[model samples]
Each structure stands twice: as structure tokens, then as C-alpha cells.
Target: MRILFASSEIHPLMKTGGLADVSASLPVALKRLRHDIRLLMPAYPQALARAGKLESMATVTLPGFPDDPVTLLSGMLPGTRVPLLLADAPRCFQRAGDPYRAMDGQDWQDNHLRFGLFARLIEHLSLERTPLGWRPEVVHCHDWQTGLAPVMLGMHETRPVTAFTIHNLAYQGLFPRHAFDALNLPPELWHYQGLEFHGQMSFIKGGIAYADHVTTVSPTYAREIRTQQLGNGLDGLLNHRAESLTGILNGVDYKEWDPGRDRHIAANYGPEDFSGKALCKTDLQDHFKLRGTSGVPLLGHVGRMVPQKGVDLLLRAAEPLLAAGEAQLVVVGTGSSALEQAARRLAERHPGRVGVHIGYDEGLAHRVEAGADIFVMPSRFEPCGLNQMYSLRYGTVPVVRRTGGLADTVVDADPAGLKAGDATGICFDAALPEALTDALTRALALYHQPDLWRRLVRTAMAQDFSWARSAEAYATLYRDLVAARVPPGKP
Candidate 1:
């Protein structure tokens, strides 16, 4: 299969969240399955620097983009042989603190324009408009950044099979109705059933409405988005397109996350011998200045400190435990000022019992996974969280809300599940702080039972959530979509 994987971000070169990680790993996985996959992303300065030994491929211009000639650079993704295509439009992508946000943390005012041009680039690549003459049979678009690709391709009578994955529906790229004029899309796209959402132009609607097939990160999330509560106002359209929707759970790249050979952690350990995990725990305690012995359970949270992550709920739920000296807390992330301040205040109030790191550090993230007795992810709505999977791989039992991939992956440590020897982690229902607190209390009980805790850790470590399974699922989907379009004798 010839696949064009389009995403706004890719890991190692550029990353803001799990999307980048998925964009990087999934293609490599597909390539391992013998498919010819090419990654398409903007030529951000960071990406250009990291993606080594490039060859200039072709140049093209979009209808409305004044940046007349966007050069396409071809390179191999670092550490993998998968072909990488970079759309080099310096004025649009070069000057960035992150891909979507300015240095001040405000979303870039011209995001619609930035990604609109990107959508056109995807169209060009999908249609084989470039001089390079290689066309993708399947163009798999990720998130709203590449949402317009399916929309653009949908206009043509003959085009490649398109699949769009909604990483998160909450981030629908909406712009003022007037902004659509700048994108130079057909006037018909202004209709309510098209790109228009209420009075705004929604970039995500392009993919959801026009793509041949749609997917979300997890099966639970696929069902959740069809409801009014979690749909973020797009439930009707989603329900309308229900037959074509799917929820393939995202897989963890164990090569990077496995604890046995992780270079980032203080000590390497696996499910069989957890002695090194104790040294990692002590090192984590020393690093965080937490004055807790290995006897006390150390809870860990690593992600954006935002309301959606249930950071507020985490603070409220864990404070009582932290204050009582029953357990210790260590949080690492950067997000909303209020939540960041609250985490710092909790650390201050409980001095040696709480630790807070305000920004992301990959090495520190690994240490937290390796060190913590339990991992906390009380997301109000998680699409498919990777850290919880990382926690499981490191034998750090995850305490997660029963939603999305967390629901799909982590088996609740209920008596029935434990008795059947199937429990991997702890799960709680509801988004309330009390629910999480109660779940944490249950985890604490389990933590005190050394033999049971060790058994649960081993169970978690033994569970497989590798990319091979996910890649196989994707390969099946691609073959199905492509087979429908191509005649039996046609290559």
C-alpha cells in the first residue's frame, strides 16, 4: 500500500503531545509491515534540523497562498527508513514557539491560513501533482490540521482513498466566516452541511463530513463523541456518519517506553526483577526533595496541567492524602496558570511530601514512570492517553477515569477482575474529585498489600499494547478502502 500520512507534528523532530508520537510511530510500524508510507508535515525549523540528509523534490503554489512556491523536501525520518515529505513554507511555519501557538501561548492568529495552505499541499501530494510523479493510494489525515485534505479531495470525481483520524474533536479549527474567503475554497463549501459550523468556518468539519471513513483514537471515544455531552456540538453530524466511523485504540511504542533498557531512567528494571525500581523510587524522591521513604507510596502525574486532564480534580483529591502523610505526590507538566500555581502551592504546603515540575522533560517523564508506585490520569475526557500505557509498561499501576482508551486499556482492579487474574490497573467512574479520591484510596489499600501489588504490576507489565497490533488494524483498513476503489486487475 502507498500511504501518505499527514500530521501537523511528528516526534523527535517536533512534538506538542501524543499526536506527534503517533504520527512518528504508526508510519514506522506500517513500514515494518512492508507498506510504502510517506510522512507529510510542515518544514518547521526544528524538523528541518532533525530530519537528516534531505533531497529537494518539487515546488508548487496554492491558489490563495501568496507564498507562491512552497518547496517539497524529501528526507528519511530519523532512526527509520520511512520517507518524509516536508512542505517548506517558511513564512507560514518557520517562526514558531510551537506549531499552533505563539511564544506568548496564544493560538496563532493565522492558524486557519497556516493549515489551509497545508491542506492544499496534501491535495497536491495525494493527486500526484508534483514533478516527482509518486502518488499515494491512501492519504491518511490526522486532526484538524489536515482535515481540509479530505474535503479538497472529495471535490474531485477521481481521487485517492482518504481516511481522517480525529485525535481530539474539541480542537476543531474554527475561524471567522470571513476567513474562508482567504482559503480560496469553493463557495459551495460555505453551506451548513459543509465547512460552515453555525456562522464560523470549521476546519474539522471538512474531514468529518467529506472523508470516506473517519476514526478516533479509541473505541470508547468513538462512542462518546456521538453523544451531545462529549460531542462539543458536532454530535448530529457524527451520528449521521456513524456507519463509517471506527475507534482503533492507539498503541504504545514499547521501544521507547520499555523500562528494561530505558536510558532516561535512574535504574533499569522489568516485571521479573523490580529491585532497580526501588533505587529509581529513591532517586525520584531525592530529585523532587520529597522526604518520603520507599515504604510510602509515591504517586505520579505527568501531562498538561489543565482542567481537561483533571489536574484540578487531582489536586483536590490528592491533597487530603498528601496532607495526612499517607502518600506523596509528584506532578510534572505545564499548562493553565491557575493549575500550575495550585500544584506549586500544594508542593509548598506539603513541603517534603509534594513535588511539582512546571514543564515537560522526556527523561524526567521516564523516571516518574519507573519510580512511582501508581500513575494518576483522571482526565475529564481522554481520547487515548499514552502515559497510562507507559505507566503500565513500567509496572506503575495506573489510576485512571473509566473513559476513552483508559477504559479500553486499563482493567479495573475489582475483586472479580483480581480473582480472575485479569486486573492490570485501577479504574474509577465519574469526573468528580470524590470518585478519584475513592479510587486512589483503593489503590492505596492495594499498595500496602505487597504480594498483591507485585502481582498486579507483573500483570500490567505482561500485557501487550504494542504498535504491531495497531499497525495491522490500520493495514486492514487501508486494504479495505483501497480495494473498493481499485479494480481487481489494477495495481
Candidate 2:
């Protein structure tokens, strides 16, 4: 099948979260399965700078928004067979230093317009038969940034089947209804069942309503989103289209994350050769300025620091954990000033016990995964977390909130019920600080048992959640969607 993937970010070129990792790895896996896959993303200055010496394609004009002629840039993904198409529009994309951020750390207010243009451009490109005669049989749209692509495809009678995957529903691309006039959408599409959402234009709502199939990142999340607690106001719509909704768990790129081959960490070690991991732990302690200690359990967390991440709860439980004097904490991420300040304050209060690196460092994150005895991800609502999977791959037991993909992945460590070599990680149902403390205490208690800890690590390392499995599932879905479009007698 010929598939065109539209996303806001892709790894190695641009990234802020797991969406980039998925956009980068999924295509490669699908390509390996012999599907013709191509990736499309905005050619932000950073991306263009990183994607050096790529060939440029002919200019194409997007009809809905005037004065912006979308230029197509072509490149081969490094070390892969997949082709990449980057939409170049400097006036809209190049104004910012980061892909979606201004110099002052504020999100660009015109993000709705920016991504709307990108979505329309992707739709136009997908529908057009090039002079070289290239067109996609299916267009896979990711998140709210590319949500309008499916909506636009629905408007076009000749367009291919569309699939929209919601990585997170909380970030629906919403703007004032007046912006619909700027979008120049058809009059019939302005209602609630279309792009409109409670007097505003919601890109996510449009995708959910118009796409042939809608998917979330995990089965648990897909079921969770149908309820008021997790829906983010789209529960009713999802409930109405329950038959079309599916949850396919996200997969990790083993090549990028495998402990056997990762070059980012200080030492490389797999399940069999686990001795090098201790060196990685010491390296992590030095990097984070935590006092190097062999006996103390080093807990690691690598993600955006926000209430959604349960960083607030983590903060509230920090002092108690430090006072227990059983473990040390090392956190790596940047988000939400309150969490940052809280992390900094904790680091100050317990100088050697808490280490806080207030920004993202890919190398440091890998070291932390390799070094830490336990990894914590207490997200209040995670769509499908990749960090916990990474931690598992590195033999770091995850301590997570039993929500979304976290619940799908981590097995709660039960002392009495757990078999010798079966337990993987710790889990808690509540998002409160006390729940986190209890979960941490349970993990700490397990850490005292050397045989149990080793067994848990080995169990986690043995788990497989690679992209090849997910690619096969996606292939089945694509075939089904394509078959629906073809006539019964047609070849």
C-alpha cells in the first residue's frame, strides 16, 4: 500500500515528545514490511538546517490560504529506505526559533493557522497526481496538527481513505469560529458534527468526525476516552463512533532504544552482561551531581514536568522519600515553572539525595535509564508513554500510575502474589501523593530483596514491544481500509 504520513514533528530532525519518535520509527517499520511509505513534516529552519543537502521539488500552491506557495523539499531518511517530503513555508514556520515556540518561550498564537495550512497542503499533495505520477492510497494523519488533512480529504470526492490517530486528545487544535472563514471551508462543514466545537473550530473534532477510522495510542486509552474523565470533551463523539474506534498500542524502535547497541549511554549492557550498567549508574550520578553510592536506589524520571505528568505529586512525595533515606532521585525534563521550581527546591533541600536537570538531554536520559534502579512515570493521563518502555528495555523497573498506556504496560509488583521471575514494575491506582509514596515504598522494599530485584529487571528486559509487531497490525488495518475503497470486481 502507498501511505503518506503527516505529522508536526519527526525524530532526529525535530522532536518534543513521543509523537516524533512514532512518526520517525513507524514509517521505517512499515517500509520494511514492503509498504510504500513517505513522511511529510513542516520544514522549520531547524529541520532544514539539520536536513542538509536534501533535493528540492517544485512549488505547489495551497488553495485555501493565499500568499503562501508551499515548496516541497525531498530527502532520504539517513540510514533508511524511506523518502521524506518537507513542506517549506518560511513566513509561517521560520519566524520561530523552535518548531512551535517563540524565542520568549511562548507558543505561537498562529499555531492554528500554521498547522491548518500544513494539513491543507498535505491533503492537496496527497490528492494530486504528480507529473511523475505519485499518489497515496491512504493518508495517515497524526495528532491535532494534521487533523485537518482527513477533514479536507473527506471534502474531496476523489481522495483516498484517511486514518487519524489521536496521540493525545487534551491538545485539540481549537480556535475561534471566525477562523473558519480564513480556512475557506465549505459552508456545510461549519456545524457541530463537522469542524465546529462549542462555537469554536476544533481540528481534532473534525478528524474524529470525518476520518474513516479513528485510533488512540492504546486499547485502555481508547476505552478510557469514551468516558467523561478522559475524553477531553470528545467522549460523546467517540461513543457514537465506537465501532470505528480502535486502540493499537505504540511500539518502540528497538534499534534506537536497545541497551545492547545504544551509544548515548556511558556503557552498553544487555540482560546477560549487566555488569556495565553499574558504571552507567555511577556516570549518571556524576552527571547529575548526586553522590555516587552503590547501595542507594537511584530513581530516574525523564519527561516534561507538568501536572499531567504527576510531577506535582512527585514533588509532594519527594521530602518523605528523601527522609526515608532509602533512595536518591534524578529528574530530567523542562516544563511548567511550578514543577521546575519544586524540583530545584527539592534538590537544594536534599543536596546529594535529589538531582534535578531542568532541561532535556537525550544522552543524559539514556544514562539515567541505564543507571537507575527504578524509573518513575506517574502521569495523570498518558496516551502511550515511550519512556517506560525505554526503561524496561534498559532493565530499569518502572513505577507508574495505573492509567492509560502505563496500565497497559507495567505489571504491579505484588509481594505475595508475584512469582520469582515474573514481576516487572510497581503501579498505583490513585494520583495522590500518598499513593505515590506507597508505590515508592513498595518498590524500595522490593529493592532490598536482591533476588527479586534481579528477577524483575530480567522480566522487564525480556518483554518485547517492538515496531515490527505494530507494523503488521497497521498493515492489516491499511489493507482493510484500502479494500473498502476498491470495487469488488476491480483488480
lDDT of each: 0.92, 0.87
User: Best lDDT goes to which candidate?
Assistant: 1
* Candidate 2 C-alpha lDDT tens digits along 1-491: 99999889998788888898999999999999998899999998878878756887878777766788778889976667789988898778877556777877887878888998998887777887334257898899999888888988887777789999999999898888777878888988999788888899998998899899998898899999999999999999999999999999999998889889899888889999998889888888888788776688999999998788999888776578787777899999998888899899989889888889998887888888898989989899999999999999999999999999998888877864376456689989898999898999999888999987888888899989999988888889989998998889975
Clashes of 1: 0
Which run of 10 residues does model 1 get worst, by summed lDDT? Answer: 60-69
- Cα lDDT of model 1 by residue, 58-107, tens digit: 88887788654799999999988999989899889998688999889999
Global fold similarity of model 2 (TM-score)? 0.98
Give candidate 1 regions above 4 Å deviation: 487-491
All candidates: CA RMSD (Å) = 1.1, 1.3
Total backbone collisions, model 2: 0
